[model samples]
Target: MRCEAAPSATSPPAEPAAVFTQFVVKLYSRCNFGCPDCYVYEHRDRGWAAQPLVMSPAVMRRLSGRIAEHLRSHRPERAQVILHGGEPLLAGPPVLERFARRLRADCQGLTTRVDLLVQTNASRLDRAFLETFRRYGITVGVSLDGTAESHDRRRPDRAGRGTHAEVARALTLLRAPRYRPLYGGLLCVVDLEADPVETYEALLAHEPPAVDLLLPHATWHFPPPRPPDGGEAPYGRWLAALFDRWFDAPRRETALRLFDSLLDLYLGGTSTSEMWGPYGSDVVVIQPSGLIEYNDVLKTVSAEAARSALHIGAHNFDRAAADPGFAAERAGLAGLCAQCRSCPVVDICGGGLRAHRHSPDNGFDNPSCYCADLSFLIGHVRERLTHGVSMLRARFVQGRWSA
Candidate 1:
């Protein structure tokens, strides 16, 4: 049975057509940590090695101009500029401040809201860096894999030393009364081997406002690790266990983005993140050298999968929107495979992340490697929600009859 290509019952209101709303600017091309699972460093893409170590003043100026032009042309109600890296902090406070100030000045009076954010490994976040972030109103999102043992296993420093202590210290600072407002949240890549409940407990220790659990970037060509003894859907079971723990907690301490998205979908609401739903792609990335590209996760698919002829030095946002890769992402569900079109949860999963469906044999015309897991998790959430609603309805009737 083929599912029709219609908006989900929970789909959000349509957004205005815009060239792009999120600009991910790569401030530096080198990272301080050597995370084994980093799509940029450990994946097939080696393009980063050839780029300039840091974004130059001239390139930043050009980027600012291009972004301002894009905003003025499209006039999206709001926009966000994300400072990404090899470690955005590696660019130092002075450089980052200049970039932020330039972008804000250029877009002044154009965008209704301008948000600034920095995604960091958090090891280098000290008092000085926090002050700079505060001055610019840039929220800090830290990447830490659960507990020390689980985190240090994959994320290490250049000298091969465990960075858990440094990350922990940074987390402490981020959660401090003064800096807590700047703490955006925690982003943890799932380590299948780690115990889900223990990992959840460890992450909650820092009291992050939210947590985003990400599936490690993988494609059909280089798939994620399989379960032992050919067991089916290990990742699905793992996520489900974590969902139960989060749902059953006496009080919801922190927002788990994945579970929250799933629950929202099941309850007839659209997803807010690119990881799910039928939201059109509204993000564009700028390399340190001024090249325009799709999402960085495309690096995991192939070395050149993310490479585009569009260069911010020459092309404006309109030219980038014309790029075939960008067009494909903008196409949304129309770009999904037939298998996805036939799936019952097509509205919820949105054919998974585009990069995860890649293969040498069929390009991206395939469902994600995590398809089974997504289906299982979504179904589990829907069932639980349906049962809960039924129970509430029954109690309401019983109370009326007794009265």
Candidate 2:
């Protein structure tokens, strides 16, 4: 594959390098499970309804070849490919098998690592699926909320019954010694009403390697329900409690990405995802139709799915990286708020996730939707550490004086 410099002169400086790390290929727009809160279907956009049920083989081939050529030029070896969708498992064995094999074959000589990952609801995770995952060294992330009651409320089947029991059974099969290594972790959406302890306990029973807690999506236009006047909403409170419990828990078993990002910000680091800061450069998503898009959130911005085309074929990665609009959006992370710019802890906070920062009117240049919750949690964590440091210093002084 031949490589060419970006035609646009608005390329970023060389030192920081491109952070284009992951590409989520929407393999299908159809899913077997029906979660009441799914953004793809439940949101007002209704775009997924129009997308083809599955990615065409021609588009997939073009995407795979294009990505390989892009990697050859850009050489960001850590770039990953996630088989995303209504449910990636909906592609079944033959499709996934071909996709993975072709992806691996296309970029054989490049130093970059192309990880094949599947984000599934675990409904169709039978022996065949597990076998495919193992064969390709694919990491499988299953979406399961907490206990039956909490999980059932939001994540249900098309028939209106809770899918918790069925998902759990599938997960158990995945962990049944034979397929344990292929399992990545559990992806759970936060339910504000459920007790944090109870939810945590329920999830811990399953022993997934990691747990990702996702906040529900809403906007100023469609703001999440708030009290009549005075009382605070339960969403932030629930997350705060979970953070507290995770901190106080006897053993740390699960890898919570949200908490990890928060901790990174609190400790003065930028987040890996656009959600945490103004990071605009390092990410990209490949749709089933062979187009390159920024975070999938941009789908809400335009009805023409083809709006984000930087370089459509297999070789546009670096060119997209050099886009002026992309750079401006990324730099916008730091200017999120006056408070964030001057805040003592802005490095770690990164002004929160881009999705939360997005206001239809303001683009992605605003404060987080969970600004209150984030500020509250960061304050609490800071205080705990500061007090601990003071106590240790006092003890040291006392010992020296006594001696």
Candidate 3:
């Protein structure tokens, strides 16, 4: 939890501080599929257009060295290395294997645990790829929207053909007995227009241990679509409906991260996802070119929104941490807008995602574009929890009095 940099001999001794524990390495800058909602490829960020299609080995080596140095200096108990991309699988198995091996070697003995994972579209998963993943202990997390119709509508190949069949084949392979353990889960971006229960049920059919329902990245500059009438909080109502369905299920199903995080917060617990609660930025993004930046989700706000001057070739994690973007993100709740600070549910919503609050005029000093939706959802959750607890307490009192 320290926030001071390691001291150098030539300079005055400085305080020690926490370094990044999660590194998102973008192995490729181009995707095979053309998901219209993808933040990297289809959003306002055109930075990827300038990056190499694939990460060079020299850059990877430099990145590994930097990460190793950071791990040694900070000495965190555990670290996560996520292989991300426009489509990480596009880098192919050979590159992925070598990168994983090199990263593992570099971090040897520096940390207690190193967890490797890949966020892939699953279009290219095959036996060879699965074998490489299994050998390197890299768990695979697939990006799936829901039912075939819902998924294909948003995710299509360059030719504009549906990719659902290919992804489904990969899912079948992943769920096989031999490969099931390597299956991390499903990452689904929420489609408010889709039937919530139907989409939830479709995902359940996949038997994933967990599901992450992500809010499509948005800002006041590029707000998400709204109903014609603009009657109410569309996204919030959709989420609440899903939450009720999930909560009332006769048996426990897959872990719905968004709902679970909110429930945990309402029950006086903390959230693990940065999307909720006051969270210090412990994640860093390493581009294919070895440039360092804050979370890539910021790209949705603007092409240069998350860009940092530091690169893995020239700077260590400490230098990246000192960057203005990184510093602002790590500031947590202190970085929120004045309006967010005054809101009652600010503690739980964390002013929504930082990227969702961006504006050319106000910078990040504004409530999220989804501020109303977040308030509605959080209030709904609070009310439900309070009522449930009240009912339980009343039952207990009555039983005691009758006894």
Candidate 4:
């Protein structure tokens, strides 16, 4: 019933103090699969090549201390530590087990509860990995790009062959009754060429609990497949189509993070993700070398975009958070451009993701290259939500739920 009009232009929320709660730990910096569009290996930043192949025990100890230090200060009820990498499973289960164990031990007795999850390509997933993950109460999140055909197009092996078979095989295990609870979600990047409905249905086939439909990371320097200031807001049209399919489904097949976040915000509820709403940015990542830096995704923008002078061994995460570079991230609405701030949907779009606002001319102060698309998508959702609620109320005489 509480609906904020989706502004005609881009916008996000006002800046509240940023408290870091989510952390990513790169167990290994090397991967078995060769995804051509991979932000880490193929993006603007080539720093991954020089990074340690896997996190050493010494680095792990320091990372634990740094994360623990942050937890002691923020005292968030629960903290999420996602294990990632070129392909974290490349490091083997034993190494993962050791990393999880160390993190738990280091943060012991802290008010914050550390929950661990591993995000993987799922090409190398097997009983060995699942068993180890299970023992530590670690959850498993696989990156399967919808159907086999669609998935193969974006994610292939180094040898130029599709990895759909192996990924599909791994998903079976993760979807099994014994492991389904650990099935964090399916992650599908928006592919404009693919049929939106087909792509969504393919993901539904997995029976995942949730789905993360990410925009292919791009900046002004390098635009997405369908650029803005033109006739079609292709990405927006695609999502709007998918949103209708999801919103009208008689039964909820999966919880989509993007759509869910939008819906929650429309209903006067706070967001669970920085992807939307006016939520303060509070995510961080630790590379295998124990460097506490900004979100690793920023590497796609530039080499130095995500780097920081802060190292876990030398500084607590608090100091790292205070670093000028990282502070720019915590800027919230203030971080957005004048055009975005004046946009009607500012609260919903959040000036697009921070990374998407990049341009050499204006630095990180420009509207996202997806500005047209975000405007289209957010505006469409707001209209549908308002109309749907109005219709539902019209159908009910009392305008209230009754058993």
- Candidates 2 and 3 compared: the better one by lDDT is 3
lDDT of 3 by residue, 37-130 (tens): 8888888778888899899999988898888888888788888899999899988999999899998899887744888999998999999999
Candidate 2 achieves a global lDDT of 0.72
Write down the lDDT of every candidate, Cα atoms only.
0.87, 0.72, 0.87, 0.84
The better candidate by TM-score, 2 or 3, is 3
- TM-score (C-alpha) between model 2 and the true structure: 0.86
- Cα displacement (angstroms), candidate 1, residue 67, comes to 1.3
lDDT of 2 by residue, 101-197 (tens): 8888898988898777899988888999888888888988889889899888888889888988889999899888988888888888777667877
Instruction: Tell me the TM-score of each prediction against the true structure.
Output: 0.93, 0.86, 0.94, 0.92
Q: What is the C-alpha RMSD of each candidate to the true structure, in Å?
A: 5.7, 3.8, 2.9, 7.2
lDDT, residue 362, candidate 2? 68
Off by over 4 Å in 2: 1-19, 227-233, 268-270, 299-311, 323-325, 332-339, 388-403
lDDT of 1 by residue, 287-349 (tens): 999999988889998999888988888898877886788888877788998989888878998
Residue 152 Cα positional deviation in candidate 1, in Å, after optimal superposition: 0.5
